[model samples]
Target: MLLLLPTLIGLVVAASIPPSIPHETLEVIPDGWKLHSTAEDSQTIALQISILHHHTDYLDIAHDVSNPESANYGNYLGAEELEASLPEYQRSAAEVVSWLNNHAISKTTLDGDWLHFETTVGQAKELLGADFMYYQHGSDDPVLRTRKYDIPIHLRDAIDFIYPTTHFMRPKWPAKMHLLPRQHIPTGPVTCATSICPKNLTAKYNITHVPADSNSGSQLGIGGFLEQYPDHKVVQQFLKDYGLRHHDKPYKYKVTLINGGKDPNIPAKSGAEALLDVEYGMAIADSLPVTYFSTGGRPARTPSQPGNKVVPRNESGNEPWIAFLQHILKMKSPPQVLSLSYTDDELDVPLPYARKVCSLCAQLAARGVSVIVASGDGGSAGTTTKDCKGPNGKLRFIPTFPASCPWVTTVGATNDYGVAHYSSGGFSNYFARPKWQDKAVSGYRTLLNGSHMAWYNKTGRAYPDVALAGSGYLTAGGGATYQQKGTSASTPVFAAMVALLNDKRLRAGKPVLGFLNPLLYKNEGMFRDVTEGDTDGCEVGSEVEVGFGASKGWDAASGLGEPDFAKLLKVLT
Candidate 1:
């Protein structure tokens, strides 16, 4: 009777089990890879698992808060309120922790929606149901990865994705500066100087005189990455050289380092990208308080490292972009306006990873933070490198990330208020067109009349939201002055403008311009429409074809055009 009862219990347990189904293939090990016998069992691996939760309600609430016409427009959620609202998020986090604990994985920590822990390669392989091996791309260093991964069916709903998993993203600093000849420098500042000084440009754009009471509580920030450090001395000299200092006082900004981020005072380690971003942002928005975020993390191995590894590599072993955004999201008092000059080609990033990043941007926007990103400098052809080439060897049109995200304002480049030829502009392949820009994009598509239509995704999100000067601006770095060009220059300029606008709104007892698309699209009169020049590159023949052009209305090359400060103030206030 005891043996029969045991057999009956075993049969019931076996009958309750469900068949396994195929889930997402997190990674695919490249062909011709050799396994590391020693690494398989002995090596310890770290995994940063991202849990999924129902964000639909939160997104809806955010959208309402962002929409100016809505009743809840200015009612943004605080960090505590946000956490409390997402019961599903809390539940998912607890479930993931419990599951890990049940598996005897004790080293785990939870932050918002991410669960981080370390485990052995053997345990990871068994846990994730995947094989791990070593593979090298070309002459690059070898990496340890798996071709595919599987999760238990029950846990799939709770997991969104994991990083350092399958996706590889390389965010680039978009500043490309050329050293100006000594003869080109003016002995004294001239009205409408050819060098395009920040003062002259600000005056031209009608942002010359900000009210004394403005910018009282408004704050602006710039994102720094890849060990790039902005020196205070460089910024001061730049302000002095251009004669834009405040009563002989050197311009100053607070540098906040995150995740081992460094701001070494050594001039040799300082970069032009950092200098230009700080100079333009501070110089333009002279009245506002500014913060420079020095975001540090391990260098991504996909685009290859810059030779030597001086900084601690893989300290967190997390992707820099994700880490940077996550850090910002958790901030209790993030800057109202944040400018980022970094970008990467859209296709280089995996779809799930890109979507997750974009969603994070949405979260930031919902909290009334206006995030600005440089579109790209690659024109319609994408980055001018071998990596952008498709498998067919044809030069493909690659859109850029963060810029391609519809939640944030994407800034393009122009020369002398005209669309710059190299200013990257196109529709996105990953994101669809949002309702705000439908009329404008539809008109632009009609103008194209199917010209180069086959090369791009027409139904995708189009950029940029606006354009600004991006050519031949003087920037100081390494104790020398250089002329910088690219959408990087344009981004900080626009970000400064938005920062000033936010200041005005805050002073007027109004909400900061959150998720600027709806407001920008609705208020066309606030900007000067650029109707000249064309963005042409990705040379197929001897002649460069025009990819997109500036038009009377919104066009991909120049979007709504440069900002008109007076008009913007009137509309916003």
Candidate 2:
């Protein structure tokens, strides 16, 4: 009877006799969420159900093609080719749909591997045997979720995991910026020591190659979330004010909206993160077509009273990462290079949800897309360490997710001199160390020699694969110029450089660089090693001034080192 049941979501379970329905727990709510009260039975709720794939060989296949040393290097797959490889996609969807239909969930929209449906709170609770309750975090609006959810043992094989059930992570954009008095834009070479701009990045990294025309099949993508619309008019003004040229082409960029994402043309309503990303990315990768992916996450709340101010809503949708990646993966020819500046604490995200996001990244890698992410803004602990303590009341350092996912290339921050103190870097608490980084991480591991054993996971995946200038950036946003700092600046800077390299590769009849970790680890000499500065925070209990320090090799502070564009292009192309 036990052998008849299959393994599901990394859990082993046994089927019960026909008289009883064997309920298997799927995912449990993460820590730091306070249960307020039971949700209203009549309240409507939306859920996304992840279906299990019959074959997952694409994970390894993604690695093989991404590795420069492999014979299948750059041999990528398309959206249809990759989906067809999953043998049981249709069968699994059929089973899951039938199960949902049996529960009276007839209205569902199936998109690839995800099945989306809306149901009443009462029906959701009765359908999945879950206790739906309102959980709140600090002063944030309370969200309706369950402590844990279970499914009938028979349907375990058809489902991977249900999202927004046990996951409580809300993505945070980590760029810190301040508005400055309007000043004259310099026409000559901008001083690199004072601020980071197009001239500074191009000259410092030896980035001399011109990006081909937009029709050359080379494009860069920036992720816009939480209504972060990139104002095109602002970017156009930035190009003109800075005296920047777009390879003799007009300054333009495209936007793709997902899940009702907004794209307001008003500069005052623009998000600083989105503006900085587009402004600098276009400036650096001049002439390359840029696509801003505005993904919707939280919906605007309706006023409880007609004349009252807008109050926060208690309901939330899927994580923006899920919606953004799902949209990109479905495209026939997605952008060759993508930069995302949003992140969440690893512990705040459930293990299954994190893994699901990682798998989506892997699929993008298989399709020959560079998935670049910010390591985070807070060093070790994340954003700020004020009253920082693990949910278990333990003095442990918190790691960042997606950055810790191992599948994507995570970049940290550096300054004019060395590693930025706030550049987030650390080992993952969820994923294990990957083989590609074994040699690189060993050098830093030996430097520690069993120190900070109680702080973070020793055998976990480490991040900030590489670091670049992130501080003191003169960014244009919201009809004003500002000085911004954070890994948010570093992420797009690095991504633009990669997009330029992709342009070179595309001209030479080669595929775009995808999954850069393996290639970067293999060629450590392409970066300038930085052995200065240390990460901030993680001061727990009486352990004052606790954090990882920069070392000779790839310590968390600045992984490998800052990019040397000349060396990278010389070796890669």
Candidate 3:
């Protein structure tokens, strides 16, 4: 009966996982638990605290919903400033963090808040310190619906432990990130992909994908996101021209088609995102050089009458999504890095689904898989283009999804100077910090002014621990590789780097640097901090703004800064 425990644990872990994320074997649960407190109280229930809960977007920047720019920006806005910006309930987040640190809580190690998991139920009056606003969980239990603390939580287990297997942008010493012209297309010929790759010289290594963009038709591209952006048509053509095809290449590449938002069982209107993802899959696949593996079914789309045929179901927060992707990649073994350009905004105390996915991402990282993600195109305000015909016909400035998932390496976009504009940033509505941001400062400089805080009240690190090129001149495929912009474009670039690192790691036989947070934060030399500038506008429009300045350390806009590909390559290699 005791030996059967491992099997039971695996089954529970698998059943609890979100559909899109992967599930690994379970680690042993510790024999005992510790009791910690924030030492504060309020009307709302505050069980646990964290910034950008899960995914690491910058924390909320507003003091009130009425003011988008009200809250202070630099360095968590300082203690005095934070005190003024938040209500009593919100300010408790700082106290929670302060108490944990004061008590010497091991942030990323298995000893304390790290690698911790729990499920509790009670009223806001029963949990941590405050009675946070009653956020609905679509659950029947009054506790979950009103003030129940059915919190399914986990934390970094080591003072410098990795997020199991998640990651994205972490620069190297002498970090200096830059971009080049449209280099290759999704289906072009294969011939020395590394040749003339920009940001490759004067340091380590650099990586990227082939047939950069996807498309097969002239009128519309495969993916909804690509077609939505300008210059997509040109990118389609570039993929046709430069990218090497599997037939044209000597090396082999595998593919996995993910319709994470699929929901035929639901209405199209209900699953519109799934519909959009269908096209997204085809578009992405068409632009690539390898064959996309599938579950023997076409990409799922939300049916109408209820189906937003153009969109699919919203599975942006599923764990099996990433897990399945990894399972499909099956590179004889897991790669050192995996890049995913997905995100979500609803993570603070993740929905049942969010918890499952977070666990999967964490497990993968523990086994050594670097997950890179896109912060978003909304800039610091987080713009969301929702299908508003039913409730919101117009797009709103809401946080994006997936990118908000804490376990994956959340990435934001940046311009040359390293400041940010509209590139999305803020705290999570669902998850919490998973260790990794902890690092000692080197003799380097950056834009941000203070150390990152781990808490939930007020605002927390919503996203963008690191940044990359997503500006004026980058390439993609409409049918071939061409140039375009947006955090979308930026996402793949980082993914490619992770891939390159994987290529190197697999050759070395080292644990593929599983769960990269600790290493990333501890290794400040891998990145070049961007302490100036900010984005303005959407990817299609210019609204966010960034000043042209270069400083040291994290900045309000650019966070820890951008990548220095040269340094990045050296470190990874």
Candidate 4:
């Protein structure tokens, strides 16, 4: 009876503790999305459950392989090699599968670390102890989701997060640029005074070397999101009008569609953002092979009407960036340099989701792929707006995501004068500063001397890792010429520059510059430092010039100045 009494007490204690814990929760639904009626019990929902993955030191490995001084420099991991390095997940998978089976959900597909399943709303609600509801973003069809969910306490260690939950990140409309008819086409060398052309950029940066045919394997990728599709005819017209030498007569580029994405050549439906991206990238890189990744999901649907027919109806449930990454990461040989000219505010994305995406970027870096992203166009404010106050109603500076992610290279905007006043640059409220950029950012912090201290997080990650000419650029599309400006223009142009450098490295038998931040920080002399201009737009009520300004070295306004192609080529080789 004494031994039995101890056993009985142990059983009672175990039964008293709650079986589940909160996994992902939000106090309220994110803005730009409205809650509709509760989802029907019979309505089906597809969920991607992310099992918590073992953290690998991909950052350390990326830095080691990218540093020029290191003996292991350029020794990047292949697909199988990287797979072998990851921790085995048999135990984690078994536990999650067991929990799902307990809820009568036996049909599930496991892809890498993600478990995919389709279940009715009633069953899903009972499984996760959540209330499912319909959420409509503008005029788009409603989506099924829950404000919060809980998982069994025993399975907490095995699962990282799940989605179709609290994450509401969707594609917004691209930046608006006023289109103007062309007055005249340049028959000779383009001048830098009127507007920026491929010729002007090549001359300004001293980019004389064209990619050789032998280095065609070195490709550049331009990420296209929402419904933006580039037209080949526009690109051809741009090359001819600008009088820039190109590899192909028709100006060809490969199209890779992901998640039911489309690549149509319809002139009327051509997108300005897509045209701007491909026009400059193809012109600058010249003969280098370029691939346009048209990723579907997060359609550009407004309250008035649906976006163009560039995406599938079923794709509305997925996130564009996630869909893009899922496709790109599977390839054995992706492009050496990939550029994305899209950005969202850091606070708008959930912390867990952001970390997960950033880790994938780190993996790409380890595989010798350089990812470049635009640093937004909101100056020191937020994404495409000039508000000084933050989401919490506090007067603070806002930073953009992916730019603040630390793994990818973030590019800011500059003009013929100096740094563009609307070039977005600030410290992140989410990620801490990486050690690689400590010296460069510290110099700027010292120059700042504690000014605007309360407006930002001092210990957070700082960005606009590099800068480029952003304004007064000419782009052609849909049989019309237009003038465009923003960090989006600068991103593709800089990516094209990197693509050329990749070609040189391949010809020289050296590896492509995988993660460029480590190398760029070490050799500040490769860039032409801009000691003038300020990122000014954060004026609230009576405050004037209430944002970050450029300094002698690295500043938030123009990061390490614009790239000098000749100097970069010499140092890189």
Tens-digit lDDT track of model 1 for 1-573: 887998999999767543334455633332223443234455566678878866566677778888889989878877666656653676777777777776689878887777888776688776777665544444433444665676657777888876655544455777787886544333344422556778777777888446424346778899998778888876777666674545434458899888778889677888888888988898877757889999876522322223523333334356667777777777898888889998887876667778878877877777788899998888876654523344244455678787899888999988864899888888898999999899999998898887776667899999999998899888766645688899998898889888888887788788788778888999989889989888865565565555788888899889988888878877876
Error of 4 at 157 (Å): 1.3
Candidate 3, residues 483-554, lDDT tens digits: the string is: 334555455455555444444444555324434444466556778767666444222244322221234664
lDDT of 2 at 308: 30
Listed per candidate, the RMSD to the true structure in angstroms reads 4.4, 5.9, 18.7, 4.7
lDDT of each: 0.75, 0.79, 0.36, 0.79
Q: After superposing candidate 1, which stretches have Cα over 4 Å from the reference?
A: 1-23, 26-41, 102-104, 131-143, 181-192, 211-215, 243-245, 248-250, 299-316, 384-396, 537-546
Instruction: Report the lDDT tens digits of candidate 2 across residue range 1-573.
Output: 667445552253222211224333423344545776566788777888888776788887898899898999999999888786554676888877887787789988888888888888899887777887777666555666776677766667778888767667767888888666775544443533567777778888888775455667888999998777778777787777653563355678999888767788797888889988998888888888899998876622223323433433323455678888988988999998999998878877777778889999999999999998998888877753533466565667778878898888999998867899888889988899999899989889899898877888888999889998988888776545688999999999899889988888888899889888899999999999989888886664566645678889888889999999999989988
If the candidates were sorted by their TM-score against the true structure, best first, what order would they fall in?
2, 4, 1, 3
| Every model's TM-score | 0.87, 0.90, 0.46, 0.90
User: How displaced is residue 273 in candidate 3, in Å?
Assistant: 14
Task: Select the stronger candidate by TM-score from 3 and 4.
Answer: 4
Report backbone clashes per prediction: 3, 0, 167, 1
Off by over 4 Å in 3: 1-253, 257-336, 347-350, 385-400, 438-462, 473-482, 535-551
The TM-score, computed over Cα atoms with residue i paired to residue i, of candidate 1 is: 0.87
Candidate 2 segments exceeding 4 Å error:
1-32, 182-193, 243-248, 299-316, 384-388
In terms of lDDT, model 1 sits at: 0.75
